[model samples]
Target: MIRLAILGSTGSIGESALEVVRRHPDRFRVTALSANRRIAALAAQVREFSPAVAVIADDGVGGVPDSGGATHWARGRSALVELAGRDDVDVVVNALVGAAGLGPTLLALETGKRLALANKESLVAGGSLVLAAARRGGGELIPVDSEHSAILQCMRGSGARDVARLILTASGGPFRGWSREELWDVQPSQALRHPTWDMGSKITIDSATLANKALEVIEGHFLFGIEYERIEAVVHPQSIVHSFVEFVDGSLLAQVGDPNMELPILYALTYPGRAEDGALRTFDPVASSPLTFEKVDHGAFPLYGLGTGAGARGGLAPAAFNAANEVAVEAFLGEKIRFPEMAEVVARALETAPATEPGGVKEVFEADREARRVAREVSEQLQREGSSRKG
Candidate 1:
């Protein structure tokens, strides 16, 4: 059995991964699981999976119930990295959201474990350091995101030098055709209603603003060793085609599947092999709707440009961009700033934050902190200006 440690076991990606494991009990075993603050959900997962250990982000005040009392319990963020690097785990699925996932990702790589990475922030914030760790520790890193997984599948036998470009598909989100004026007063509830995929609140917001695609562009750069110039994103409303790869010979290959996270999760867990199961939905072109594509309007979604620019600049720029965007998204969700101002906050943070070469995870965290601080300040300033104009 392939022993697995699934971080963020309560999240959407993690839950989907568990579903895959549930289907293939003979091929995979859950050795460890983690959650940020959802004790009830974590408890249920622990009881069902019967993992060797379970970790939670909150303090150990209200300890988890002794579900059979066979599992060891750990509390706090450090446990996530510690459990991920354990010798018993053959694969570590880093599905934890935001910058919080970087530590577990680095630790999994450092311990020479196969990393099924679903968290894009780890790459966006510390791609260099994470890659170096993998090289030093001799661990293989696999992309769990649908786009990256699709790219990997297309480039199976093809050499990287022969590749021309990586084409990533977007769902165009809920605000696909909204003008600047329409987006100014958009609420969190509206932004959360994603048209294609069911994702977490933060990621859904990012998708609405096209910022998720930008983060994926940076992630694709690090994962596939592709340059930013060769990476492109198109609005594909169907969501059937996850991504495409074009070669210098003018040949294009695409991975098409139903818009479900389970396929990618299953593929990551069972790499170099295919699982014959009826759990995942099969793609039927005849039964499905017509596929369509459109050019992304960067004018409507400026955060995409800002994020991709930071990624191309290298060093701490991508980290700053991600940090600032996270803060801005949180502020927007909390109604502290208008929806349109989220991009403005990230832009100001990127403009003000110093770009330095991050030597290690420590430096990346420092840059993230600085960017978040600047983003909050920028949001406050914008809010004050709007209030003054109203007065």
Candidate 2:
């Protein structure tokens, strides 16, 4: 059985992962599960999966029922990392949301466990550090994102030298055709109304801003030995073509599937062997016809270019960008700033923070902190101006 440790067990990806494990019992086993401030949900998971251990990111004071096994509660942010690196875990699935995932990803790679990564923030924040950990620990890293997973499938058997470019498909989000004026008054509810995929709130927001695609581009740079210039994003409302890879000899290969995260989760768990997932529906081209593509409007979403540039640099720059965007997005969701001001805050934070190569986890953490602080300051300044105008 493939022993697995799931980080962020209460989140959307984590739940989907558990469902995959449920479907393929013979191939996968849940050894450990970790969650942040969701003891009740973790308890439910533990009772069902019967994992060897469970770690809670929050203080273990909640009234979580016990599962019929050795369950130990760990407190603090680093608990997830500890759970991920445990000797019992053969594969660590980093499904965490933001910069909080960086440490666990580092530990999983450092401990030489196969990492099925769903958390893009870890790579965007500490790609170099995480890659070095993978190298030192001799562990293989597999991406869980649909786009990266699709690209991974297409690149199989093809030599890295034979690859020409990586093309990522976006769902165009809910605000796909909205002009600048329309986006200025866009509310959080409107942004969260995704057309194709069901995801966590932050990711749905990122989808609307096209920041998710930007993060994926950075992830592609680190996951595959591809350059940022060669990675492109196209708006495909169908969301059928998860991603594509163009060969040097003019062969373009793509992976098409239902817009479900479970397929990628299962692929990561059961690599090389396609398991029978009854949940996945076959793609019907005739019924779901009209697969269209268009160039991304940089004018509508400025964060796209910023993410590409940061990914190209491959240093603390990506970390800063990810951190700033996280803070800005949170502020926007809280109605602290306008939709357009979100990108502006991230751009300002990037301009203020000097990008440098992080020597270790400490440096990466420091850069993330500095970037978040800068983003908040800039966001507050912009919010004050907006309030003044309203007054």
Candidate 3:
């Protein structure tokens, strides 16, 4: 069995991964599970999988429960990284939502475990570090994102050099054609109601702002070693076509599936191999008809361009962008700022950030830390200005 340590087991992607394990019991085993908080959910999973270890990442928040099994409890954020580097676990699925995932991701690869990565922030904030970790430890890094998974599939044994361009698809979120003026009044509730995918609140907000696509573009850059200029995103409301790859000979190939996380999740677990799972075989081009595409309106969703531009600038700019966007998304969800104001906060934070190459993970974290601080200040300033304008 391919033993797995699934971080963020209580999350949307994490739960979906457990479903995959449930479907294919002979192929995969859950050696460990973790959550930042949510003891009850983690407890429920532990009862089902009987993992040897369960970790509470934000240890002080949740009350620990009786394992009622052979499971050992681990506490604190450090436990998350420890779980990833465990010798018994063969795969580390980093399903975490934000930059906090960077620690476990680096550790997992550094320990020579295959990393099935769902956390885009891991790459967005520390792509170079992630690559170096994989190289040093000789571990495999497989992407869990639908777009990246699709690109991997389309390559079909071809190297990155043989490819000319990569085109990633977007669901257009809940605000597909919304103009910049229309987004000013958008609320968290509406943004959370994503038209295509069911995801965590933070990612759903990123989807609404098109920041998710920008993060994905940066992630694809590291995952496939593609240049930022060659990695492009388009608005595809159907969400059937995950991504496209155009070869040097101009042969464009696309991976199409129904908008479900399980297919890509399973694919990551069984790379260069196919597993039979009837539940995930939900692709019917006839039914998912009218496959359409359009250019991303940077005017409506400025975060898309800002984030992609940060990726192009290289160095720690992408790290700063991801961190600032995380703070802005949190503030927006908490009703501390309007939807459009999130872009303003990120823009201000990015402009104020220093241009520097992170010599190591410490520098990336420093960039992330400073960006978050700047983003919060910008958020507060925007709030004060809004009140003054109204008064």
Candidate 4:
């Protein structure tokens, strides 16, 4: 059985991963679990999984009650890295949201543990470093995201040289056809209603603004070693086609399935081996609706350009972009800024933040800190300007 340590156990991806474990109890075992601030949920997961280790991000709060005192409990970020690097953990699923997952991602790779990566920010913030660690430790890095997983499946038998381009599909979000004026005042609730997949609020917001696609573009670059120009994102409303690849011979390959995170999670867990499970939905072409694609309108969602441009610039640019977007998303969720202003804050941070070569995780964190600082400053300035105009 594959021993699994699932970070962000309380979040959407983590929950789905646990469900996969529930279904395939004979093939996999949960060895460790971690949560940011949801101790109650963490406690419940600990009881159910009875993992060897459970970590909580909050301090001064008792984590999951040690039911019968059999489970080990740890607290804070250091514990997260330690648990990820444990010798017993065969696969480390880094599902923690935002930059918080980066450290454990590095640790898991450094310890030669298979990393099932769900947190795209880890790559967006420190792609070079993460890839280097994976190489040095001789660990496998498998993407848990549906799009990357689809691309991985499609590129199985093809050589990198034989591949011509990659096509990533987006659901176009709930605001797919909305004009700038129409999206200016969209509330967080409206953005959270994703039509295609059930996701956490932060990702749902990122999808609405198309920032999630930008992050995926950068992630594709590192995962597949592809050039930014060759990677493309198109609007596919049906959400049937997760992603596609075009070979040098003009032949296109696509991975089409129901928009369920469980499929990707299961794939990551048992890669190179197929499980004949009935729980996964089989795609029916006739029953499925028509598939359509459209060119992404950069004018409607400028975050796409801003993030992809920063990624192409390389170095700390991607890190800064990721950090700025995280802060901007929080501000928008808090109602401190308008929905459109999240993009503005990220753009402003990117413009002002200095781009540097990230030599290691420390340098990446420094760049992240600087970018978040700039994003917050820009957000405050926008808030003041809005107040003045109102007055």
Candidate 5:
């Protein structure tokens, strides 16, 4: 059985991973679980999974080991890293969203553990550093995001030389057809109503704004060793066909399924060995009609350019883009800024912050901090201008 360390157990992806483990107990074991907050949820997960170690980002969630066994309650992101690097963990599922995921991912890779990566921010924020760790430690980094997972499956039959380009599909989100004027007036409630997938708050917002596509574009570039130009994103509303790969022979292979996170989670757990969980069902074309595709309107969703630029520019740009987007997303969710302002904040920060070659984890961290600072400053300026107009 593969001993698993789920780093964001309380989150959506982590919960789905735990669900996969629950279905097939003989195939996988939950050795460690970590969460940022939501102590109740973490505690509940601890009780159910009975992991050897349970970590919380906040100090308040300490001194509670109610589970009958000896459970270690670790706090902070450092504790997450420690849990990820433990000798007992054979696989580390880096599912935590945002920059918080980078450390645990680094630790897992440094320890030569199989990293099933769901955190797009980690790759967007510190892909160079993470990839370096994988190279140095001889660690295997597998993509857990459904689209990337689909691409991975499609690439199985051909060599890298045969692969021409990778097409990453997006659902175009809830605001896919909304006009510029319409987008500005969009509230958080509307943005949160995703058509295809159920996800965390931040990601849900990202999807609506098409910033999620930008992040994925950057992620695909890193994970596949493909250039940003070679990577393509199309607005596929159906979402049945997760992603497709084009080969030199002019054949396009697409991985289609019933849009479930469970398949990816199970694949990450068992990897080379396919589990007998009976979760990954086939894609029935008859029921799922009309897999449509369209070009992304760069004018409407400006974050597409920002995200694509980050991947193309490489180095610190991606980190800065990720940091700024995280801050902007949080601000938008808090109602501090309008929906259109999300892209505005990220773009403004990207302009001010100069790109750097990612030297190590420290370099990426520095870039991330600087970008967050820049984004906050810009956001405050926007808020102030709005107040001044009212006055």
Candidate 6:
């Protein structure tokens, strides 16, 4: 059996991963499970899976653990890193959210374990460091995102030189064709209602803004060692064609599948191999017809450009961009800032970000912290301006 350590066990991706585990008990075993704050959900998963260790990343989860089971409970964030580097687990599913996922991602790869990465922030915030960690310990970093997973499958047998370009598809978000003026009036409720695929609020907002595509582009760069120019994304409303790969010979290949996170999760678990699961195999091209694509409207969704420009700038720029976006997203959700202001917040945060590349993981984190500070300042300033306009 493949021993598994699933971080962020209570999130959207974590729940789907657990569902995959439920289907294939013989193929995979849950060695460790973790959650940020959902203590009740964590407890239920522990009871069901009976994992050897369960972790609650938030210190303020309140109350003590209920003893008497085979599972031993752990608390705080350090426990997450320990579990990732442990000798017991074969695969560390870094399904964590935001930049918090970076440390465990580094540790898992550095410890020579297979890292099934669902956390885009790990690569976006510390691409060079993550690449170095995988190299230093000979760890396998497999992407859990559907887009990256599709690219991975499409380029399975092709050499890096043979692969000419990659085309990542986006759902164009809830505001697919909304004008910039229309976007300014959109509410958080509307943004959270995604066109396809259910996800966490943060990711849903990123998808709505097309910032998620930017994060994916940066991640694909580190995962496949592809340059920014070679990787491009289009607004595919259907989301049937997950990704496209064009070879140097001008031949293009596409991985078409229904939009399901479970397929990618299962693929990450048994990579370079296939598992038999009927539920995940349901896909029909005939029923899903007239799949169309369009160019992104930069005016409406400028966050896409801001994020990719940061990726192109290299060094801590991507990290800063990710951090700023996280802060801006939080503010946007809280209704402190308007939707269109997210791009401005990220842009102003980037202006203050240190120009030097991160020397190590510590530097990467330092950049993140600083960028968040700047982003919050910008967010607050925007909030005040909104008030002034009303006054």
Q: Which run of 10 residues does model 1 get worst, by summed lDDT?
A: 59-68
Model 3 lowest lDDT segment of ten = 60-69
Alpha-carbon runs more than 4 Å astray in model 1: 60-63, 66-68, 388-391
In candidate 3, the residue pairs with backbone N, CA or C atoms under 3 Å apart (3 or more residues apart, or in different chains) clash, namely: none
lDDT of 3: 0.93
Order of candidate numbers by lDDT, starting with the best: 6, 3, 4, 1, 2, 5
lDDT against the true structure, per candidate, is 0.91, 0.88, 0.93, 0.91, 0.87, 0.93
Quality of model 2 by C-alpha lDDT: 0.88
Q: TM-score for all predictions?
A: 0.97, 0.97, 0.98, 0.97, 0.97, 0.99
Q: Per-candidate RMSD vs. true structure?
A: 1.4, 1.5, 1.0, 1.3, 1.5, 0.9
- Model 1 lDDT per residue over 227-314, tens place: 9999999999889999999999999999998999989888887887888879676879987679999999888899999999999889
Q: What shift in Å separates residue 62 of candidate 1 from its native position after superposition?
A: 3.8
**Model 3, 58-120: lDDT tens per residue?**
967857875555899988988788999998999999999899999999998898899999999
lDDT of 5 by residue, 174-293 (tens): 988888888977889999999999999999999998999999988888888888778899999988989999998899999898878989878877766676765566678898997789
* Residue 388 lDDT (model 4): 92
With candidate 6 superimposed using the best TM-score fit, by how many Å does residue 279's alpha carbon deviate from the native?
0.6
The residue pairs in collision within model 4 are: none
**Model 4: runs farther than 4 Å from truth?**
60-68
Q: Going through the candidates in order, what is the number of backbone clashes in each?
A: 0, 0, 0, 0, 0, 0
Model 5 residue 263 lDDT score: 95
RMSD to native, candidate 4: 1.3
Least well predicted 10-residue stretch by lDDT in candidate 2: 60-69
After superposition of all CA atoms, the RMSD between model 3 and the true structure is: 1.0
What global local distance difference test value does model 1 have? Answer: 0.91
For model 2, which pairs clash?
A: none
